[model samples]
Target: MILEPKMIEEVQAAVQEAKCLGVRGQGTKPALAMAWGETAVLSTRHLSGILAYEPNEYTFTAYAGTAVSEVITTLAQNNQYLPFDPLWVEAGATLGGTVAANASGSGRYRYGGVRDFILGVSFVDGSGQLVRGGGKVVKNSAGFDIPKFMVGSLGRYGILVELTFKVFPKPRSYVTLQLQYASLHAALFAMFKLAVMPFEMDVLDLAPELAGKATLIIRLGGLPEALPGRVERMRGFLQEQTEVETAVLLENEADITYWQAQNRFDWAFAASQLVKIPVTPKQIPTLDKHLTNTLRRYSAGGNVAWVAADDMTALQTTLTELNLAGLQFTGHTDDPYLGSRKGRRFAQRIKKALDPNAVFSTND
Candidate 1:
């Protein structure tokens, strides 16, 4: 059964009556939502709209079910945007779903992720109570940081009813440089070199190419007139300091479309499973060796891995062998978690405190 709640009181009542409930927004991630088994799915579709927006203060509050696309459009009109670049917006991802999934895109490389921008949240707890945390303003720092805790919580703690986020002025212009390297080692070396420099890169991503080669994708955002010089300087730096084979610069509509494709996961459309794994650059070389047949991309300077694979069992085995954990977003599975588990003990403690009745899914 599915329940669509249109208000806080409705959400509270739904939680109060349901034996076990799974929360969702638009159902963009069906695998993760369905992991709750036979529970009634609580859809936040009807509970939508922006509540408040303060352009001067750079903050906005909206219903949890508010479409991320709407938020982006509204912010664009104000010459501002969410710097973390919430992902899956074009795919009908809701503000609440993005927060619950912690789905930030490549832009997170500069400003940080979903947890960094979220200032406040209102949710219905397991006991059918409405709870508010943090503040609508940005200077808030008085509570238990329940807002941050709700990030990536996947409704295990509470069902987010509304959220407030801090945004930044949108950059006037943007450019992307795609640098090719003969090998992953060379590309990684270039990434390390670029990381230390003050390039102020807005995005740094890596992807493997044929024959063990790799491509380093970098994005820069700033004044329109100043972008050309900056792009040349970046190209010159890589050419002189690293073993970069070639560089392709994208601008205007091309640059916009490229990133949109990435944010939409267009390249991984053929894969049956899409999983996100937190990783460091140092661990990527070893991890890459095992993902021979999978499609993967490294974002945030190799701080995160998005993997698309057809063989779920094989991927799970590889992650387990490497002592890594992954959260699946697509495909079927009894559990969305794969490989070695982490933070279970602490998560369980929080779950007990927030949802003692076990009304919500136990997964994090």
Candidate 2:
């Protein structure tokens, strides 16, 4: 409970001794990985700061406990960004914890997810021995993508200490546009069209609660003049083809606030069980019908569904009926969080091979 390990040696000792280790930056996504009681907790508050950054080479290496805010601030000094738009910025979050949880936000739509950006990692494995995987540079003929494997593992394999990521230069400007549609079918169809087209949206999300009304927010970043042309093109395409009742362009201070709300949904469900269900684009309708009673908010252009509900039985049954993966966030031990691994036997075997000791201290 009294976890404030500052040094790497302390981290190794804590990880080796505890039955399970819960590493957290800011506790932003408390529902991310359930805490197995009677375990050692490693707080990355002390292990914070940017270790190195090179603007020309497009690379940044920082300690695990480094606040994403600090990283962004430092990156901004050089006009750079993480591109992934890591969440929980207000709290003291760390780079290592972020990679361990594999938590990504909507900005990931442009380049990719955390898994795509993280180039290397340093961790204290189950044996308390420090192991470094991958290289500091952007390109490397590494043995394998060890960093990617660590992602979404949720601190089950080891205690991630230091992280190295490829960075991108920040854009000149940004614009947010709200495109309205008369119905879900129309909005989603228009969204699908925009997705396939050759354009990059800062974030694209749909809020379809009011019957016969849907709101699709499209974000664009670039030189100021270029944004209007793109927005006009998007507006013309939607207005001419799709049934658009109206369209609104939100900018300056208002746009920032709107995107903030759209981005920070994970923290909203601190007390409830936050379940992430991955479904195909075609399954949204089925999901809308099946999980109607449950409080649901979607992100990543509707590819990921976040459901906060206290009832595990109903959630599992609905997900099972739809033949989808229902990853539970919080619940009694009787019901597993990751609903079904369908074909994860191989993954289980791989975990066994890597850690070998079955790191009893991790939250797999």
RMSD in order of candidates: 1.6, 2.8
Task: Please give the lDDT score for candidate 1.
Answer: 0.89
- In candidate 1, stretches whose alpha carbon ends up further than 4 angstroms from where it belongs are 136-143
Candidate 2 Cα misplacement greater than 4 A, ranges: 136-143, 210-212, 266-272, 328-336, 360-364
Q: List TM-scores for all candidates, in order.
A: 0.97, 0.89
**How accurate locally is residue 303 in candidate 1, as Cα lDDT from 0 to 100?**
98
What's each prediction's clash count? 0, 3
Instruction: Write candidate 1's Cα lDDT for 47-145 as tens digits.
Output: 999999999999999999999999999999999999998887888899999999888899999989999999999999999999888884433456468
In model 1, what is the error at residue 89, expressed in angstroms? 1.1
Query: Candidate 2 — number of clashing residue pairs?
Result: 3
Instruction: Output the lDDT of residue 320, model 2.
Output: 73
